[model samples]
Target chain A: MEPFEGKTISWGEHNGVIELSLHRGPCNEIGSETLEELESFAEVLRTSAGNMHTLIIHSVMPAGFCAGADLRELYRRAYQQPRTSGNSIAEVRNFLVRIHAVFNAIDDAPLVTVAAVHGVAFGGGFELALTADLIVADRTARFAFPELRLGLIPGFGGIPRLKRDLGNGIARDMLFTGRSINATKAQTADLVSQVVAEGEALRVAHALASQVGKFDLNAVRAAKKFIKPVPHAELLREIDIFCELFESPAVAAGLRRFVESNSPLPYLP
Target chain B: MRTLAQTTDEILTLAAQQFKVARETLSPNDDFFKTLGIDSLQALSLLTRLENHFHVELPDYELQDVSDFGTLAGRIQARL
Candidate 1:
């Protein structure tokens, strides 16, 4: 398939390995534009599964791999129409559905998938990384599910994926505490497959992709399918919980605080 | 166990080296936000560096009110 270059993301296949780069400025905050590109990419990935052996996702921005869902945009859109009119929750649910579709596509992709993470990967960003079969993090990589700070749970399949990979205890600590963990801590929890030096995540991930490519694609696909099943039921339940929480006054206040804050530590809870 | 003063000195040294500032330029009393000219994201990078150096997990929430090298050291010192 032809390479895609979009406003928020780009992708190209080289030597049977697809490299998807997240490049939106100030760290890739997933917004409508990103969702659209990801949807397109998912479609392409589904159609091109027969040709590729591995998929590597990484960010080109210095700030991080991704900062998570765009709260500013989320706030602006949510309050655009009157909350009493019931359109706000509807819009949020719609966005959640679309994003979940994209993430599920990656989660169940036939080829081996990897996330080359560095810098901040919080909230939905962390959820995105959880979709990967393997995460190769640089020393600078930090992961967290900060959704609880905004009076919401991770809407993009984070809890199920985290529980599936690291079990309930670690998942609960991350979600309940809304704390960020460094690459070393994440590796200790079995979240990261490898932790390389700073600025080396992509290079190491590429090397891994090269190694994965040498294996029989059929065996790889079958193994991935056998070991990794999408948590379809729980993911849907998470969306419902998120939407239920999004309607509360606390979520609005939290999003407002995040969007309007001038504090240097707004990323902190 | 290292003394608090030693931890503070180590933090200052790590901060200087990580941010490429002079070790002598960073004081225990200086607001690292201003001293290092770092925002929250960069501050977290510093926190990660400190955590790795000390082999401790310093939750960002605990550091919410902490801005000075001395206070930051105290937090790490407590965990240590």
Candidate 2:
């Protein structure tokens, strides 16, 4: 009935189809605290069983899906950013690194990770959908990248993931504008695998998961593992550029100012 | 160059397919917003699909002009 294990994300199993719903309801918004839960959840999903085949991520809200990282967290960080917070500066630093890790795990999972999205999925929410091997969107589902609007780049691999998922130009448009595109456009943009008739997102996703559950999990895992050896120089380029920005004083000040201001422009950053 | 009717049929058909709806549901002369009740998801999917299929990228600002079938058809025609 419930979906949590020791204050972290929980998984529900039925006929070998694991539904890892985000129970951090009210918004299902990701943040410093939830990053660890996500990372741990991904591990649980990925290493579940040799026979297990699918992982479905849905939210507990009626307007379900995620709202991205908490802006309140951003504000808190801006206010109390440590001078020399090495490795991970309390909340912000820890969250940034861990969220990326969680996404990587989701992307690399042996079984297909399906994002069953409805209502609003913006910024990190969009990126979270990007982490899925496939996405099933409801007709009313809204997808967006509002980070720029808040004067921040999506720290959890929005640009890189979008580029790899949709291509560079499309990624730029999504990132620079911070506009919310509807679910169908997201599918057309090749951002998702499919879209179902309204209210059928979760149902369709579950059906697909059942089908996936019948597959040979080991072979699937091995195939994914096989793709691991390819050169990641381009990925490294993106990460390096990102890290350079992280070290930028102008960026920090700009981010601080933007977080402080009533409105922040996401484009300049 | 393709005739307007031919172009309209070609693009609209592909766009309709992107909507994952039956071909009978969409028409060159049909009213898009009215007939399709083009809500945001449907509208966006149709727009993005049309853009990608035609290799013509219509930005969000441009999308605002296309509220109905006739309007969207006209916008596509103008781009051509």
Candidate 3:
């Protein structure tokens, strides 16, 4: 198979298992370029669905799997002058919509997907990892939904996917607390399928991918199809709620404080 | 609005359903994790259900030391 490289993703297929490595900024934040690359990558997968039995999304950068979105970008956009303008609002809305679509495509793909996560997977990063059919994390991996700290919510269908995996009770805890859960705790919660030693996430993910890839493509696809379909309406509802929250004064104030502090958000007891 | 006693009763009922034990078998003094043979994640799940049922967001810090059913019930009751 031909090796494929994009601005943010490098992927190749071997034995029906495709390894897609995310490489972006130091922490692999999902910026606009990364989103565009994912769009193209999804198209490639769509065309090769028949030959691809499994996919593993891992990170090549040592910084982390993904630190979520670019905080700088978020701060810049949130604090930009003329925030009330229709053009600015429309642009932000479209960006979120496009992101949700790509993530949904990944979630709805016929092929089995796995996330090989190590280091920090926060916000959008955590949501992306949750999209996979299975998650394999290293002991060093940490997952959280810190969006609420910034006066935002998980907009990329993270909340609904989390609810599906963990039910509302545990899911809301992660959402409300914005606290990180280690791989061991996540495994106990049944959020992670396997937890390997540090630096072994990719290797374990490859093994799992190979096992899944060994199955007949038809049966694999059929199994995925037979499973319950995601309630897409919920995702739409989440996006709508996120966009509305994004426009609120509270989010603006929160972003201002975050930018000014230039440090972790403090918790007032 | 439910009375404190009513809320406590409801919380116990919810815990019974979640932990899959007879309500009669549990008391307010029983440690939640010990009784359920569960962990923090399970506790978090219970907290989520309580939040949904009560329509309030309980602080995680306030819950860190709550190990028994009575403390958990009291917290929920206070929030309500």
lDDT, candidate 2, at A202: 86
> How does model 3 fare in lDDT?
0.78
Checking candidate 2 for backbone clashes, the offending pairs are A148-A266, A184-B45, A185-B45, B32-B69
Would you estimate the TM-scores of all the predictions?
Answer: 0.97, 0.66, 0.74
> Candidate 2 residues B1-80, lDDT tens each?
55567767776677566556677777766756566555443455565456545555455656554555556666766776
Per-residue lDDT for A46-89 in model 2, tens only? 56644567778887675458767666566566456565644323
For the predicted complex of model 1, DockQ is 0.79
Docking quality band of candidate 3, CAPRI definitions? incorrect
Candidate 3 Cα errors over 4 Å, as ranges: A81-86, A264-269, B1-80
User: How high is the lDDT of residue A181 in model 3?
Assistant: 69
Model 1, A1-269: lDDT tens digits are 78999999999999999999999989899999999999999999988768799999999999899999999999999985456666888899999999999999999999999999999999889999999999999989999888888899999999989989996777888888999999999999999999999999999999999999999999999999999999999999999999999999999999999989988888885
DockQ of 2: 0.05
C-alpha root-mean-square deviation, candidate 2: 8.0
Compared with the true structure, all predictions reach lDDT values of 0.93, 0.65, 0.78
Instruction: Return the top candidate by DockQ.
Output: 1
Off by over 4 Å in 2: A1-8, A81-91, A222-269, B1-80
DockQ order, best first, reads: 1, 2, 3
Q: What is the per-residue lDDT of model 1 for residues B1-80, given as tens digits with 9 covering 90 to 100?
A: 99999999999999999899999998899999988999998998888888888999987789889989999999999999
Over the stretch A1-269, how does candidate 3's per-residue lDDT look in tens digits? Answer: 46789888888988878888999866688878898988877887777756788889999886568878766677676566555554555666777888888888888788899999987777889989988888998866777887887778988788889977886766888898887766776887889999888789999988887788778888988898777367588888997888888888888787677557632222211
Q: What is the lDDT of residue A248 in candidate 1?
A: 94
